[model samples]
Target: MTDNENLKTTPLDSLHRELGGKMVPFAGYAMPVQYPAGILKEHAQTRTQAGLFDVSHMGQARLTGADPATAFETLVPGDIAGLGAGRMRYTMFTNEAGGILDDLMATNMGDHLFLVVNAACKEADFAHIESGLGDRARLEILTDRALLALQGPAAATVLARFAFAAATMPFMSAAEMDIGGISCLVTRSGYTGEDGYEISIPAAEAEKIARLLLAEVEVAPVGLGARDSLRLEAGLCLYGSDIDTQTTPVEAGLTWAIGKRRREEGGFPGADVIIGQIRGGVSRKRVGILPEGRAPARAHTEITDADGSVIGEVTSGGFGPTIERPIAMGYVAVGSSLPGTRVNLVVRGKALPGAVVRMPFVEQRYYRG
Candidate 1:
């Protein structure tokens, strides 16, 4: 537990405490790391049932302009101009050298673009977006908003009870709806690689909405610890850890998020460098790792070859409860990145044998169509 004196508290701060949440400092907020249910059980509950996560600390904003999509494309490589109404695109703000500033979700909200950025990077992200696209549009941060994610196989079943239309939303879709008469902007997506919805509601109504979802037997209140394990198992990147100002999309295994048109036309930031990487290939790449035995490898662990010479380092690693194995993700030499390629992770001065494996150690259950 960090000094809570200067930390920011979310709208449901008290509610979380009452629920027996082990509060900790995360991204400048006093947030729950796990609850009385514990991280292991909470994580298992999410995979088998549903998990409710309070993501209000994340930055939400709207960009309005004569043509928001066209104006916004200048900052990212994604084809925002092609983003359809009610559709969401995962993209990043690349620097002039093609390094990722931050990864974000941009939803086409017809009149404007609604965006969600990482909590830790929100301030810088907002400032960058403003400097890059402000002249072309109006950037308004949603300070009064609270975001909630309900994810798992039973997510739709529970959300549908509040808003029937929620059950019909396909993956990567967003809509403005009234869930149990509570106004919200819902997105049929999640970081857990599970079929779920992210609901953005008024800050004043956050507690009310969270209470409603927790009241359902299918849903359990999940904390940051479980959220981290769940996302890692899904092979999702965490900003500042897996990616940063020094990492490009090509090196991060996120080139897929860069649209085909953007790659061909070469317009966004660092177009020359990124496009070159797309065609010429990168020296190293982000890869999934599976360490043998029970000891879990953690971030910053050195990766080495058969000869014990250093090659790369683990970015995120831990025991994945869903897969019941020690799962990890890291950047390794391209040749050493193939699945089954033997590698070693230096943990606590001891080199642990491991191998490069396909991502999503636990198979993803994202809803399609």
Candidate 2:
């Protein structure tokens, strides 16, 4: 029972409570914030060993049409038609002005396009997809499905037992497989910048598969608290927090997500403005920050120059378990975005020394076959 007005529960809500998880509101879901082992240990465990995350609160859907590629292409700028079946792409739904509506992952499942979108923005994403594609594309929200993420160095080895094909899956590849007799869609991708898999399965079968995964020695249940710090350490953006309608892909350091072809032959919404920013360069760019001391600079903290003149603001910030330091990400004037540049973070009205550093705070160990 969620007391928070905006909170919803995932299929594994009861299971989390049973595991001594600290439940909290995140993206409208009453999800596990952390377990008894705590955030620091959970975050470190995921980096060195393995951690299981209940991401059932995410939105999963199927896009069907006689020409799914054409239907889907209109919604996002990614080269959907060129995507091979059983492959995944990171793309964004852009507004008319070229601002990001939401960042999403789409997998080509041969017959239909499978999509996993942010839970907080799913309603708007679905509505955009439906209204834009109309009868050309049929959007089927997979309400009966639950998603899970197993991340870290040992994730592949543990998952290989059930989904043998996953052991060979390179980054961004996906496949249809059976795990413990349950049909599922498995992708070699994660937000933690670690080698992992995102598994989508029937909601009814989630508890069973989750229990089975947890039984593995290296796989521990990680909660939202660890998830946030992990992604932050990985230098990944949180939609509404790190990025929004006010931020463009170029401004957010996501220029790579924009296709080369799309850059030249603009067609998607906001193409003109995006192309302009790409060519001329954005005034402010997202950069990583390494604080001098232990105090973690949090979101909304002011970033200033040596003279204490405010330049930008922190979007995501936390103490990195793997890096063992305070790290943050925020936009700064282009001239000051270079690595090794001296800056200061204004926290609790004190000017804390910080330096622009290369991200991710920790190296990513993705299995790039």
Candidate 3:
């Protein structure tokens, strides 16, 4: 556990406090859990309008070399070599045993590849990259920057007011643009599964950019609480909870992230194991779980079958504000992973009826074009 006194603060820390954000320790940083509007209201605000988030705690870095993409592919299973310029791909680093190390975003920025890693795993992730690549690419950690996410249905309109071109960028594409007169690397992507952009800005100007976005009528200052619920409703994985070093991509329902070429011609770490799983299938698979009652199943909640047999456990669970019901994601025996398969959640040592269901409890509203 990170000591509260040693926790770091983001560039938008002051603004968060000014907006009555309730700060809490997260990933070794003092991040806001929610604002005065509360989690429920904030969650609705993002779905209906727009929500601004401070994601500066995430690690940002640049990898540059003669052929960074080809070199990068040596570490992740994603098709980094095939990633087009200004396009982004979501991929993960795996261990020798095929367990996920951490998931990350790799953006092909023309001359170099830009990476955004989870805050909790940055230090070790960077070291792993350096050791694995071994001078094949130069890693430049961008410590003097901040990341902001403007998410929701109205996010495009809110951002368009400052940079009209940003509103037209295709989903998963990135570009260098000026927003409110500050230079930023804007990507039409977000964790909420909404039409939004993740803006990377200079640390010193982060507050200015944040304030400008918040000044918009449809924009509200959101915190980590709503962010979690939003991603959950979207059926996205939360690194430490939904996925971990003990979980493989195949088991986590992320086999889609492994590029076809990489799958056929394996070379990256754990390729042998992951490819084998892809071919033969795995014993367990991640699936969406919808508890029948209002009682929300939480992480580590024991999951059982109708016959009172333990099958798996919930990895992430909560009451989805948008769905207005209890939803969860967990790994179950492959036979029980089918949608509509009846299951039981052992909450408080009592059996609670639930069933397997298709995910994305809320429709992903990304603007594909």
Candidate 4:
């Protein structure tokens, strides 16, 4: 639905163009899909070294109230009340039908809950949140901020220069710190399933911070292409692609995001159906698919059994530069969702041999330490 003719640009837009970024329309923004180094090199670099991503298009906001957690938990089925200060949790805003409106990260910043939602759904998401919790909470959209993600194995090493304790910060934790002399909120989490930081700084200083991060020996400026590949290899679901209004957390392999308290209290929207699914299970589930040979299976590719019966369809698929092979994830009937289950991905006209495999085709290098 994004119109290519008139798309919003991020703080790093000019810088990205200067670096030879292949500009494209993404989530209504003029974003970079790749640089001259290409998607393959960017993917490999991020897996082995570090890659910087401009993610300012993502929605950032703060919820402040007498009890922000309780107010926010009305829409999301997560234990917001149980989150400790400076901790973060991945949760989804579920609709009354037990479907996801949007998936987001909520950080308990002591005084309030800091939330970041998907770029494509921000306007609708904020409106939904505001209409529901307006009386109980004050929503302040951080429009002046720019978000940057520094991800990969070498991420912490590069960021530690500005904030030494960054190397020690546990995954899914956030802190207000100064990076390269700029005041920012740094979260020791990212989409790539690696040790990293998502920094939120003033929009005016975004390009400056990005340049500083890229100046590091191990860091390279990556684009949306590598970001998608990295997250796909991590087995993370894409907002509209793998999950959406029709998909529930249980169906999308995100049951872990629904906390015990929320599940037991049953106050959130769609609790009736979601809780039922938690107890009874779903008919189909999101699973990993590994295609044999060099041909990469793409999104919407039909997943079929050996007998040519359609089982599911590919959601996100691409070649993982780090794994050096084609990897994909899609929804399949529960009977065929188990790892090692033989399957076929109908690519173009041929049924390519594949298997329902365990997710994170590339090992998660998260720093639990």
Q: Tell me, by lDDT, which candidate is best.
A: 3
Summarize candidate 2's per-residue lDDT along 185-247 as a digit string, tens digits: 899999898999999989999999999999999999999889999999889999998889998
Poorest stretch of ten by lDDT in candidate 2: 1-10
What stretches of model 4 exceed 4 Å from their correct place? Answer: 1-5
- lDDT-sorted candidate list, best first: 3, 4, 1, 2
TM-score of each: 0.99, 0.97, 0.99, 0.98
The candidate, 1 or 2, that scores higher on TM-score is 1
What does candidate 1's lDDT look like per residue over 1-369, in tens digits? 357899998998999999999999999999999999999999998999999999999999999999988888999998889988899999999999999999999999999999999999999988988888767999999999999999999999999999988998989999998976889999999988788999999999999999999999999999999999999999999999999988999999999999999999978899899999999999999999999989999999999999988889999999999899889999999989899999999999999999999998888898885
Superposed by TM-score, candidate 3 places the C-alpha of residue 289 at a distance from the truth, in angstroms, of: 0.3
Error of model 1, residue 252, in angstroms: 0.6
lDDT values for all models: 0.93, 0.91, 0.95, 0.93
Task: Give the per-residue lDDT digits (tens) of candidate 4, residues 258-330.
Answer: 9998888899889999999999999999999999989999999999998999999999998988888999999
Tell me the TM-score of model 4. 0.98
- Candidate 1: which stretches are off by over 4 Å? none
Off by over 4 Å in 2: 1-6
Clashing residue pairs in candidate 2 (N, C-alpha, C atoms within 3 angstroms): none
Q: Candidate 3: lDDT over CA atoms?
A: 0.95
Candidate 1 TM-score, true structure as reference: 0.99
lDDT of 3 by residue, 1-369 (tens): 446688899999999989998989999999999999999999999999999999999999999999999999888999999999999999999998999999999999999999999999999999999999988999999999999999999999989989999879999999999987889999999999899999999999999999898889999999999999999999999999999999999999999999999999988889999999999999999999999999999999999998999999999999999999999999999989999999999999899999999999999999977
